[model samples]
Target chain A: MAEASDEQLMLAYRDGDAGAFETLYARHRARLFRFVLRSIKSRASAEELYQDVWMRVIEARATYKPSARFTTWLYTIAHHRMVDHWRRAGLSVVSLDTVDPPAGDPGPQRHAEAREVLTRFAAALETLPPAQREAFLLHEEAGLTAAEIAAATGSNEEAAKSRLRYALAKLKSAVDDG
Target chain B: MADERDPKVSRRYRELGNEEPPPGLDESIVSAARRAAEHPHAPLVTPSGRHRWYFSLGAAAVIVLAVAVTYQMQQEQPDPFATGVSREAVKSPANGRARESAPPAADSSATARPEAATQAETSGRQGAAAPEARMRRDEAAARSLAKPMQAPAVETPQRMLERIVELRKQGKHEEAGQLLAEFKQRYPGYRIPENVVRP
Candidate 1:
């Protein structure tokens, strides 16, 4: 069961295997949580959106197809959920407008010495345009390539690569500044 | 091409540490999935199931349509006994007068006969007499229409010769002559009426 591919687990779950769903959930929970957490400004909203994404997966189990990688499929749901959240919050998803850094640090425990650099990176991530931040999160957290990122975010590979490049450049500069 | 990942940026991003959903959230989501999977019928329906539902509905609609069409066809054909009654009513002069007097009942009797008869039958002795009377009138009308007096009698040679004499009396000499010639051709062995010969 542990050696089963994500697609295999999803198919099993679709066929009424609850255990398979638990395994699949355990496998991607952390990365998906982090991806949603970094994409949005509010921890509460991110938590809600994250759970909604999984619920969508549950609701969609009957219709789940394995044409794409499970990670790409999962991130696609997360990406769309976040986009809906941004739209409801009246945030511009397409604009490259930078946002104010969220209040306090939005990260887990870190080494005392590395805390400053982590803070700088977290703040920089929050300030990035929504598309670039999503592109970066999909690439880093979901382990998706540019093409997978494009697929997840419903963008072309060129745009996805550009967003990821710009996001990495900004985060790099912010980290170096520290 | 522009899809390069910077090692320094990656390291810095990793330094921000991993953030996870709260344990409660995880439990909620996983349990929901398990509940859905375990029950199987509890959550979203499959496309195949939806198609089956549509098929069932469509089948039901077709069955209903067939029944309705059959019923309509049945209604369109005249009932033989009722057809006899309507024909007598139209043919007999006395029944036509009766129908004219009861215009509304006559107009709707073809469709409403069974209902009116049933109602009258169940309405006790007084009301029962009405349908009985209607039945009696219908029978009488049918008998009158079937009587020999109502039938046209076949004409005989004597009647033809008398008709020719009448035509000659009415100053139709040429027509009378044509009829005499035809009578002679048809009944050559019979003697002509003296009145026809005089004409």
Candidate 2:
């Protein structure tokens, strides 16, 4: 079958078609897993949270409503799950500011330049508050609108805009300093 | 150098700086989803068919018991005035005999003959008992009015299922899920079938 929309796949899954769920999982899993990994910083924890999120989805299948975009809804669940995991572990929230840039083996000069820029950018992203980082990621990586970000974060539109603006300014300053 | 100074620096960063996710993440999530789909924790403790029948029977039994108790109470306490009235009616003919023994008069006898005597006797008995009969009826009405009204039993599972379906149809899946969770908590044993959950 042609690729179905998230809403279509969810509805199909609700209607007892497991394959539709598989399709949805295939479409969203990598991005969701990455998103969780970035927020939580532990590969094993990310994997566990990933399983928990999908299990939540399954438990919630009977009651699924498509009020927001599917990915927005999915990310909200992931966000909450991460928050819960953080709380339970009694770990202090890590400031994104202190993240060291990943240093790989020296390669082509162009590749080296790109890596430096990326490393600086990652360090800058780590400096932002979780909410700001989330807003930025949703905007830059997921291509969500301010409205969608607000909905995902349960914040107002103005707040989402402010966070996005701050995130961009911080990234710009970090890159300049680097 | 000019590219770094460009106004679209933020946009460029976004385009070129996206992280590649770790491998095998998708496969793991899909595997988890498949496992959940296959082994959804539906307890087989109560069959729906038997549960519905039991509910119906319980409701029926309550209604039947209420009616039987009411009937037994009514039979045990017959209305005193009704019985008195019926007794008076049975004894009216005997009382009529004394009225019939009265001497006849020329002017009034023609009009006051047998009919007048019988009418007078019947009217006296009914007049004596009418106030008591009215009081009994009023008391019965007051008793009925004093009883509390019972709300109809809610269709617990079916209504919740329909609500979830309606919410899903409206694309409010998250809210629907919350409501269903609340419903499940409220009615712990009711298994919302897999078919209902799928859509």
User: How do the residues B90-115 of candidate 1 rate in per-residue lDDT, one tens digit apiece?
Assistant: 43546745654542221213333545
Best by TM-score: 1
Candidate 1 clash total? Answer: 0
Tens-place lDDT digits, model 2, residues B1-199: 0111224445434433234344565555555556656666652122467587887899999999999999986765332222112222223544323332432111111222233334444555677535444444444334334432322123446766886888788887886786677767777888886644655
Q: Candidate 2: which stretches are off by over 4 Å?
A: A90-112, B1-28, B42-199
Task: Evaluate candidate 2 and give its CAPRI docking class based on DockQ.
Answer: incorrect
Q: On a 0 to 100 scale, what is the lDDT of residue A62 in model 2?
A: 75
TM-score, cand. 2 vs. native = 0.49
C-alpha lDDT score of every prediction, in listed order: 0.72, 0.61
lDDT of 2 by residue, A107-157 (tens): 688566765766666666666787887777667655578887888778998
What DockQ does each listed candidate score? Answer: 0.31, 0.16
**Span of ten consecutive residues with least summed lDDT in model 1 chain B:** B103-112
